[model samples]
Target: MTTNAIVTTPAIQRLATARAAVVKAAAAAQAAHDAHSNLLVKLADAQARADESLSDFRSGKIDEATSALRKAIADADAKDLQKMINDSAENLAQLNDASNGAMLAEANAKVAELYEQRVEEGSRLEAIISEIESKLLDAVVERYRVQAEIDPDSLKWMKIYKPSPALDELVRRGRVPGF
Candidate 1:
């Protein structure tokens, strides 16, 4: 009923809000991925070192000393590797423990879930935006159609931008019944 108002303004506002959320989610997701990736790298390095240590210990003390040295070294260096693995396994649920180097899994999972949800929301926003754009174009064309009907000056102007000659020819032929 209000001719002056652009009907798509509210949707555009909603789109801005949605875009902000998407940006935030994407950023958090990237940060989480970076952290998880770093922890994994650390775990990998620790595992390699532990493997080499265990291998050296095993090779050097292969006889009667094998069992005792294996036990001692495994107890000491094994703890380090185990702790690293556990740290890598930590997730958002272990946030408190994570702060102290105990959990990465929970944070990784939560952020990944958030990322998925925000991406879906962003997709919905994109769909609605596309719909609004399409309808707005239709409204513009209808406005031009109506103006071209009554005003010869508008008809002349419309002719210049006609995508094809059909609409222009219809207007040129004068306002007929169906048209």
Candidate 2:
């Protein structure tokens, strides 16, 4: 699956079987990632830890690093980062298309219904995208509410957006997704 090698280095970072380093690196990454929701920030921290761990492992004196790096990758809130990425891409594309009526004029129906449910009454679209972006960010924030959270995703959590029963219906019918 990995077409390229996992490289690191003052030297050429080779993709060899360094089990201890690899395992430790994954754990460290997960721990760092768990602390943040912004994937870029999370992975930046993770990479720093991995780089340090790998460097230490290469030197054969990894005691102090081992304990801290032992956090299980499975414990990560987004253990399936790849899956989340795929889901986000697919969901975003579908929702965007529906909103723009690219698929069909009727596709807008789905988005309008969702808007009615999620957006506050009498709140007109702010430049067409401002409100939607806010909602998505809020939802993602809620997903990582333990740490990387800033906004409430649903009305129950805030006065900003209301819950959409239509959301449940769309999910039930597989009409719209990942709202």
Best by TM-score: 1
Q: Write the per-residue lDDT of candidate 1 for residues 101-169, one digit (tens) a residue.
A: 312433444455566668878999999978976896787777778877767475664453443466446
**How good is model 1 by TM-score?**
0.35
TM-score of every candidate relative to the true structure = 0.35, 0.27
Candidate 2 lDDT at 22 equals 49
Candidate 2 structure quality by residue, lDDT tens digits, 12-93: 2222223334455555454444433465455455555556666666777676557346333322423455456555556555
Model 2 lDDT at residue 86: 56
Candidate 1 stretches with Cα past 4 Å from truth are 1-8, 58-179
Report how far off residue 90 is in candidate 2 (Å).
1.5
lDDT of each: 0.58, 0.50
Q: What lDDT is obtained when candidate 1 is compared to the true structure?
A: 0.58
Please list the residue runs of candidate 2 whose C-alpha ends up more than 4 Å from where it truly belongs after superposition. Answer: 1-37, 59-61, 64-79, 102-179
Model 1 vs truth, CA RMSD: 14.2
